[model samples]
Target: MPDSSTHPTISSAFPLNVLIQGEGFPILCLHGHPGSGRSMSVFTNALSLRFKTLAPDLRGYGRSQTVQNFEMPDHLIDLEALLDRHQIDQCLILGWSLGGILALELALRQLKRVSGLILVATAARPWGNHPPVTWQDNLYTGLASVFNRLNPGWRWNIDTFGQRSLYRYLIQQHTPETYQYLAREAMDAYLQTSRQATQALYKALNQGYNRLADLPKIQCPCLVLAGAGDRHITPASSQETADHLPNAEWRCYPNTAHLFPWEMPNQVLKDICDWIERNPEVISFKKPEVRSRGQ
Candidate 1:
């Protein structure tokens, strides 16, 4: 909502809307489910102090036009197209929740383009090991109900105010009408991509795209950050992801939930910036040579 319209728009396989802030090496940040690139603007604001940040609303979410047959492959292709538009040959990727999974997939498929990877509160088998049935059910039901009402032909106009106004109206404090409007906007997009999204979810669930098995294929330094109290993904899941990546540093925040970035922005920012600073040469960042007994 911060006037994202001020950013550039590019034509790819789909119409792509992106926000680029600051000027330095690129650090692309991806947001979680049912959310847009604007959701991770907190990170962009922080990282923009040092690095150029590219945040795009994934396909089927926010300002990005929905891809009719949405899937992991579609997302990867969209990302590739976006990069091609920008003429960015290589960059770092930071993804949260669902976005993290996509980031990993992109890194796996295009190793040379990715310099480093950062995953937060993301798991390989997210649907298979969800937090609770009730929560998941509630989310899907709410989304489905909302999607049913939108006109499939309506297109979202990319703008900065849309992000700010909507976030304030929904995420901050919302009345019934506010919820209704947000639901309407969301559902309109959802109805268009529901079938493909559902199919992709089913395949991802059944195939078990194990981040663990795919870890060894990653050629960049990786950082895994998890919230200790995240029911959706336990510390053990983070451990499993870290174990898979040969060059991964893992950390768990003791008093955090699944929403670490929202709850403890400054702390998360420090950790990420510190890691990036230390790893000036991508995977070249080294852990301390000595180990502490307390650690």
Candidate 2:
């Protein structure tokens, strides 16, 4: 349950939904697709021990309002507002899944506001295309289509089977309200992103300006976290992203899935904390020149 003693506040910058705690330089937590910030609580709670953490439900997820006309750039605008609201000029950013896209975008564009970056199980490539020779894509698409028809205007309760089943047990740990909030926000994210975001993403597929190509442009020291058993995003994909970056380090957690942050929070936090310690200057100071993608 959320701390009722401390009221939840809303921001007008995409009206970001946020959870703040701890002490030290700020660290913004961005969750992946069909995900709310709450999903990464396992990672956030531990990170809070070393740094002030702010986990925001990305635009269109959780309490954040969806933009009527959305675009890739909206993500940056929302993060900008968050930094301004928190009076944080610069901070470390950690993103998982779809949140990793936003993290990369912010690091590339608003480099001045971000210091170090941690990308968990995310690829530099636009993940809009169906995987070649894999029935998984067809299965997921077919299921999504069926769910879309069954639950019109409902975001969370549509498909309670396939993908939902994978995380059901973990979700059971949360309070009823928290679970409901997560469910509703997931539905909203699916609905809001399925059209504009998804189309724009596919359009970018095969283009040279993808996550992989953009890595060398990021001057900040990055920690690329990947799971060995991430079937959706093969281990090779993680290695490829690491290979392109100028100064990126990688750590693989054995026997883990795409949800490594939640599944193995301690290791994830240690990796991030260790990286920040080794590169202390990367945080708590201005290093805009570092992020220029000078190619």
Candidate 3:
């Protein structure tokens, strides 16, 4: 639960449902594809000791209203509305997986509004460098598309057993029970959406999204964090992105995969706060110290 009295907010005009916490240095937290604000809420809550956190469901995911088109620009428009609503001038952005790409784009589009960036499991450009899309990816999406064509209602089904199963496979956590707990939390959070919507978001974000040339154009400092075991977006991608950035640092957690928010919340918060401390331009003043059960 959020400590902020006015949190778990849903904007009437824009309909971007958000969970706001902490009191200083607003940091926007954007969750990955097929994920909702609750996906990152755990990590954001951990950071409440240091920086203020704003975790919002991307358009069409979680409690936010479904968008006609789930494109990168559509997501950005919602983010702009968030900034305007909060009256925040510029703050750091912490993006996880797909959220990393959005944070990079936000910094690229509005450099002044983005003071710093923390990209976890993100890429720079030429997502083509990864091996060709897996057959599993194709099969799941193809089946969903086929089902939706046959029955439009199938596209909006909330039973995300398949999605959660795939996530368990991707997130190589400690135990099956722990993974199940994490997956169930996310499944409950991802209400009112479908696999077709997931495919649409992946397509929109991946299409023509080569930003190698634009990486150098970013004026703010950046930190790229990756998981050694994340096959979806590997460590090499994070390294390539960090290499292209003028002021950036790259780090990878051993034996960890994607979904670091759930797998390694403490480490994630520590690195993020450390990066902000190095920049010193962000709002949080004290060095962030977070403790984890196993860490």
Best prediction by TM-score: 3
Please provide, for model 3 over 95-205, each residue's C-alpha lDDT reduced to its tens digit, 9 standing for 90 to 100. Answer: 987788888877877777788888988886524233455777666644533443344323142133324234433555544333443545554455545454576666765
Candidate lDDT values, in order: 0.66, 0.65, 0.69
- Prediction 1 global C-alpha lDDT: 0.66
Cα RMSD for candidate 1? 11.9
Write the residue-wise lDDT of candidate 1 on 91-204 in tens digits.
899998778888888887777778899998886545323433455445544543433244221123112222223232122222333334445444443444344555665576
Q: For each candidate, how many residue pairs have backbone atoms clashing (under 3 Å)?
A: 6, 5, 0
Q: Which residue segments of model 2 deviate by more than 4 Å?
A: 1-13, 126-209, 287-295
Best by lDDT: 3
RMSD of each: 11.9, 10.1, 11.3
> Which is better, 2 or 3, measured by TM-score?
3
